[model samples]
Target: MTQLDTAPARLSPAEPSVAEPPAASAVARLTTASPLGRIVVEGDGSAITRLEIERAGALSTDGLPDAPDDLTRRAVDQLGEYFSGSRHDIDVPVRLTGTPFQRAIWEGLRAIPFGATRSYGELGRDTGRATAGRAVGGAVGANPVPLIVPCHRVLASDQRITGYSAGDGVPTKVWLLDHEGIAHR
Candidate 1:
């Protein structure tokens, strides 16, 4: 990921800048330091939309717009607290975009509690879809908001740490669980 200390591209006064507040409805990006690495958070002014833990030096912004927003600032602060082990939960507003099934799975994930975990099948069963384990796993994998949504708390059927889409993958998942005081094999 690019260095957060570096200033982002700024518009000159002579140029006609978009009148919209930075990150209000349009995309805004911010990077905050973390125990694992630098994290890039993308959002619309209303809610946090995306989060990426930098693994390689590269940061991804495939189709995202650039701007500043208060939501991003809040998210960064919350994340900082989380990494420092002072915050157990994220209270920031988040915009989750996904299919109905995915959204349901995401909500289920949110309820898993701090320092606890549930298997995909267990999550599906708890959500009243006992036979949709694979589907539930798919939804968890497609989660748009990772840390805030708490997808890392979801484990494999055997309670093993499985795939993690952020940072260094499964290792990052283990680290997160460990930070929450949850033991993981």
Candidate 2:
């Protein structure tokens, strides 16, 4: 809701080179962060398809205009509040797709309260896969909804604020933590 730019992005080597990546049946809108995009996708007319994190190649690919829909508009507004420290939780329906194990990991990630975080090991334990921290990391990385699902709230077992992949890098993780008024312990 802060920064808005709808310019087309040049493809990068890291991006999928498929001539067609499938038409995005969704629309993406910008958030406060530069590489962040909040998208609302639908499958059945009121049912949401996916609320996802899109870095780049999103706006044009999703065929989005500068503005958002009523639901997307609300999402943008609430996210703005979250980033500005006026909000802590999001109340919206989101549909996600993943393997059963990955879904379990993501579910555990959702249980981590706001302004709080868990280590990979802790998440693995919570999910009843005590020694599956690496699996948890894989699921965390595969999370379709990052901020909405709060994957940024997950950290390494040592409690160090590193290894975050979203945004430019770990500084973005620090910012999210700082915004939530949580300090490293």
Best by lDDT: 1
Please give, for residues 1-185, the per-residue lDDT of candidate 1 as tens digits: 11011011111112111222334345779877788787888876666778888777556863455565887887888888888878777777666666556666776777777888889888788768999977887888877778887889888877777788778888888889888887777
- Report backbone clashes per prediction: 1, 0
Q: How close is candidate 1 to the true structure, as a TM-score?
A: 0.81
Candidate 2, 19-69: lDDT as tens digits: 222255554343333224443432222222344444443432255444345
RMSD of each: 10.6, 10.9
Off by over 4 Å in 1: 1-25, 62-66
TM-score versus the correct structure, for each prediction: 0.81, 0.69
Lowest lDDT 10-mer window, candidate 2?
A: 1-10
Scored against the true structure, residue 5 in model 1 reaches a CA lDDT of 12
Best by TM-score: 1
> lDDT of each prediction vs. the true structure?
0.72, 0.57
Name the regions of candidate 2 deviating beyond 4 angstroms: 1-67
